[model samples]
Target: MNSEARNQHVGKVTHHELKQTLGTWQLWGIAVGLVISGEYFGWSYGWASAGTLGFVITAVFIAAMYTTFIFSFTELTTSIPHAGGPFAYARHAFGPTGGYLAGAATLVEFVFAPPAIALAIGAYLHVQFPGLEPKHAAMGAYLVFMALNIVGVQIAAAFELCVTLLAIFELLVFMGVVSPGFQWTNFTKGGWSGADTFSMGSFHGMFAAIPFAIWFFLAIEGVAMAAEEAKNPKRSIPIAYVTGILTLVVLAIGVMVFAGAAGDWTKLSNINDPLPQAMKFIVGEHSGWMHMLVWLGLFGLVASFHGIILGYSRQIFALARAGFLPEWLAKVHPRFKTPHRAILAGGVVGIAAIYSDELIQFGGQTLTANIVTMSVFGAIVMYIISMLALFKLRRSDPNMERPFRAPLFPFFPAFALVAAVICLATMAYFNFLVAIVFAIFLALGYVYFLLTRHQRETAPTDALLEE
Candidate 1:
């Protein structure tokens, strides 16, 4: 065979397939776990930007976008059912360049998100144990979760379900505990997005609050990453995505609203531990309920952190398999049948990100907030590309067997696309520095992608046949 033909063939690669151990419920666990952290924190930052009433409007709009996006995105997930998620969808709909863009964006969203969650995990731990260092705790979390993921998908999903359930229960408990203190007036205090009324300032705060509202549902699409390992993805993915989005919408609104009502919402608006802080206002800082929230709340953060590890690993494996990344990173564990190297690779990056607080600075924002915005930037980009792929595929591959067609057809996807564009523009406008850094990150990856094309093109199709 010619060198070009040789590069396109594969013969020695072991089957890179993951075991089909995920069911509808496990998929739901993953779907919920991937975003439950948003309920615990992050969204409150919107309040700081827009005020309680302003963030309220922003959250409702964001929730609508996510609702529409998930309904449409399910079509891609079930139709393609690939580990690469958006990358695979874009590749099938467009081509290699599209695949490269989606894959690179997925890496940014999945990889960067975990570090922010990890730091939150560390800070949560610090509240209970003043002796433990937050950074060390963050690094330790990466080690533990990465090991769990590398061991097996079933093990990882099960843990995700348990933590996710606990996390959900804790949110419910929080709303209930603080219910008596909830005053409608408190929610509207200094209302209109941060000002007393809707003004130029409110408009600015409203747009600036977009990313924080997005944080509420940011990584939920990551469920698409685990689609391949799902049992009967057509059926399970539909159930998981639909139910999961609804579950999250309720929790996000409830948590945000109740947290606002229980105390001075402004106090919770800018902090990482908003729930705990809000609870303390009602139950007293030294109260047992406040203490429980601080501890059990860790489950919410853990769920997202752990779930994203699973997500980023799968994206790495998929990109590697398609020769977008180093092919060796595609290997499935011989015994565990998991993407071991991919998991570890993402872990190292996340750990480094967790420690880069002093080494890197951007736009005078806290490292965690900046990281959250960075993750949101990647997610919105991926969302726009995924929706474009949906539109293109409907025309290009009309006969493709779609198990779950997006309801409302063009309308749903169109709404998602518009919302995503608004989000990306607003985020970049407000966070010019972080946006530049994010663009630089993607550009560097694209350069490496271009330089490595020859080797990747030459990779053997050895693993494809096994699959």
Candidate 2:
């Protein structure tokens, strides 16, 4: 081989490969950790839009969409097994532009969700120490979790598993503590967005609640990003995705229903501390159980905040490695075999977002509400692209090896695709201002992609970087 070709081969094949040290259960940890926090908060906001009963209807529909999406999305993850997740599948299906869009949307989802969760962590801490500012607590969370992620994926996943289990246990404790106070009247009062029946008013509220309903399963799909690190992607991916969705569905419904029943659901409708506050209705504000919920509740937020940091880092690394992003972000730590630079890059965005929550306001939405909607918008867009990729790959590469075919094939993917489109439309309509902000982000990112395209095409350092 010529010197140039040999150099290209070595650079592509030998340098900066991510360590594949994750197992099926560890993958499960990361999957559940990514979405468990949704049950603790966010979903309650749907109650404001749709009330308890109406939000439950919205939640059920969102749950169905997620169920089908996870089942179908697994096919792509098992087959492609790239750290870029949906970006890899879309690129293989369409091309560079498809890849850039998917990567950017996933970037928006993972990058924005953490800052929202981090601020919640800070807010939770602020209640305990009146002197501490929530943003300070939030910025501290970013520093700690980003360091954990940069250290190593295996260690990060291990910590994720421990915290995830603890979070689940604490949520269960919350439900049990509040069960006695749960009454039918309390939950049903002011339900259906205060409508006597399912009217046009109720429809408006249900559609408005789409983003918050989505919160219950928002980042569950992030498991796809971890496929490259899984000890057995083909075997572990399906197990983690399927079981993770099921776990989250049961928990999401249980937590929301129980909390609503515990008191006047209206009071819980628009707050980040619904679960804790619901427990307070039962045990009193200063009860020991309330204190436990305040302190232990943080694990739910941390699991997601930490796990998403791991996710966005891998995505940035994958996109950069493929030359869609600056190649420096692709470099893995030589000793740790983790994408350290990618982790820090994502951290910078998240911390900036954490600080900007108070500074940036739109349509009367707070940082948590606005960013939650923004992340949901990114997620639904990515979901639609991913499902399209599944259909495209099936026809384009009929000879590809099949480990886990999406069950029911066309029907499952088609259902997921349609639901995602509807959700995206309704969310955009209801959150027009945030939608505009999201679009501007994509426009600028695309401009950056166009500028970088030529350099990567002519550069042969990665002769077949990802043809």
Candidate 3:
């Protein structure tokens, strides 16, 4: 065949072919499911830096940013509706360089998030079976979830919906069970971490707490990444984005307030199992509430663990299909119609991250903290680029079909952008080592993309535009 003919054929072969099986509710499930674990643990870490009040202030600010961001971001998802999510929007808005950075940041965000969650899952399991090793359980969780994802998208979405509902119900039950133990003094004790109200130390602590505050809504954007798999991208994507964020906002505040009020907030601030630990005050250590939390709580972590693995695999598949990563990673399973290779590749990365602390210590940071910081770094980068893309597309593609427009226009998106930049700066200042490592990774990936630019540039045009 001639070069043109060969290119045309390859275009057809390489185009993204993800199955569309997700309905509006399923899309909501994936969005909520991907971040439900945040309700279980990570947010408490904010208290370690800012105490209860300071962290609440930080969480409120972060919540505003997320609300604005989701509003602005849904416009892009509805209009573009590609598997690449931010990568697709960036590509359309700013071309190849922007796309690469966005995709790299997304890869970092989605890929690293799972390891942190896997560790949390391990902690939950270890709470139940005292003899079980956390790391072993983490590896087992990865293997099991990755396999479920490879089976089929429909099946995976169904499981996600089920587990997410159970997780939501569990949180409500927790709030009821702990409400009787609520004590204002307990919540406010050490609430400022010894910094006088509005002092510089308190300000710095609040800044340092941004990442943990972000934990409440982190990866909620993964809903956009599932656009290509949605049965009705335009309608369902918008519904999912709005409903998912609202559900998360309610849950985040409810859990944070009740958990803090139930006992000394400081005690649960930096632990892997905050809810159960807090419950120890109301119900004894061996109480039924604790037992239920230890067992049923696993569903919350598993929901996110399973959901994020789905997200990261699609991200990997999108990048690989775009020639940003190895092409084989883009292949869909013949029967399952899933990106099995990409799923397994992400599982490998998550497993490796889980063991990185023991395998190779870096700056003496624990594996969980390092991975969480790394994931936050990636998320902030994506947030900045995605917000910027919304502005750019407005200017560059003014006539593009938008099923949902952000309410406040420039102001809302601009707020989200500025907030994201601030959060990024704060994380870099507070967690310089993890920020440095993430920067190096992004730099290396960009350099590799530059070296391979010619290959991508010469690839079939249809495949490049298919996204």
Candidate 4:
């Protein structure tokens, strides 16, 4: 087949539609549910790089960045509500090249995140059941949640709400259970990695800790991807985005402070099951409270695992519907009204990532850190592009209807852009291998686009419901 013929045939392909059934609360559920697992694990790695006080400093800075970014991002989402999320914003601002990069970065961010979360889920299960291999358990989790998402968005979102609520309740219960053991001295001890005062090494550690601190609220922006499925995105997107960030900020700070105060803090620094481990300091290793935490805490991981799968699938569908990826992936199940092909495609990549990490060793480093760093690399790229899109749109399309304008305007987005650049540079320096791998993936995506550019140009773009 000639290139022009292939392009014409691709243009003739039909696109399936996503159903709109989500309301404000459901949107909040998905946003919070997507990131709630950060409370359960991942953040502890910050302490491994920086001490307690150092990690706290990093956390505060990251929290500020997210606060500013979320506000600015909400404006773009409401103004151009689409499942493409960052891709749509960049497309409107910069054209196909920019759109392709933004979409690829988002795909990297959402696609890589689940494998890391899946490992944590396996760790939680392993803590409860000694016989369960973490890898096997992680694969099982991928199968179950991907199936749940494939069933339907409403059912998936409803499940997310229930599990997110349970996860929040468990966090509260953990604080109450461990409050008696909390001591100020424990948190402050070894605060600067045993140094009497801060030094250049401490400063570097703070920078290196950015990705782990990011884990606390990494995929919160994913809420914007649900805009197409949202009943009234203009109103509900802003409400859900704002409320969800506030909720996560509170949980992130609460878990960090309380978990540190409850024990040596160093012990849980790099562990997969930080919450249950910290609880052990208060209620002995075999205590009933600890057991309850181990079992219930699994819900936190499940919530995020399930919610993020929903996020990545929508992103995949959006990209395919717009011809950035294969159009067949944009197809929805007639009965379920879900993007089953996209959901399954993302699941295959996630599950493969898990096995690849286990079976293949890289630079003598653990799989979890590499995967997490790769995801952070994608996130930082997305942040930079998305923030730039906000600025470009304001100047390029002043008359655009913005139901929710970012309060500080240019300052907020500028701050986020700078912060994202710093974080990206820091991660590249500290995790050169993962950064290289991410760059390679991105380059390959561009190459693929170049080879298939004709098809995208000829393809019908109106099929996607970009509001």
For candidate 1, report its TM-score.
0.96
RMSD to native, candidate 1: 2.2
Q: What's the distance in Å from true for residue 131, model 1?
A: 1.6
* lDDT by residue for model 2 (1-467), tens: 57876577456645658899999899999999999998898888888889888988889999999999999999988888888899888888898899989999999999889999988899888988989999899999999988888788889999999999999999999989999988988888878897646667898898888888898988988988888788999999899999899999999989988998998777888778899889888999899998888889989999999999988998998888877888788888888989999999988988888878555566898877787778888899999999999999899888766689999989999999999999999988888998999999999999999999864553334322243
lDDT, candidate 3, at 312: 93
Candidate 3: list runs displaced more than 4 Å: 1-3, 194-198, 358-360, 458-467
What lDDT tens digits, residue by residue, belong to model 3 across residues 177-248? 999999988888778854435567888788888988898889999987788889999999888889999999
Q: What's each prediction's TM-score? A: 0.96, 0.96, 0.96, 0.95
Candidate 1 least-lDDT 10 residues: 458-467
How high is the lDDT of residue 296 in model 2?
91
Per-residue lDDT over 189-234 for candidate 1, one digit per residue giving the tens place of the 0 to 100 score:
7877656667777877878888889989989999888988998999
lDDT of each: 0.88, 0.87, 0.88, 0.88
Model 2 clash pairs are none
Runs off by more than 4 Å, candidate 2: 1-3, 6-10, 357-359, 458-467
Q: How does model 3 score by TM-score?
A: 0.96
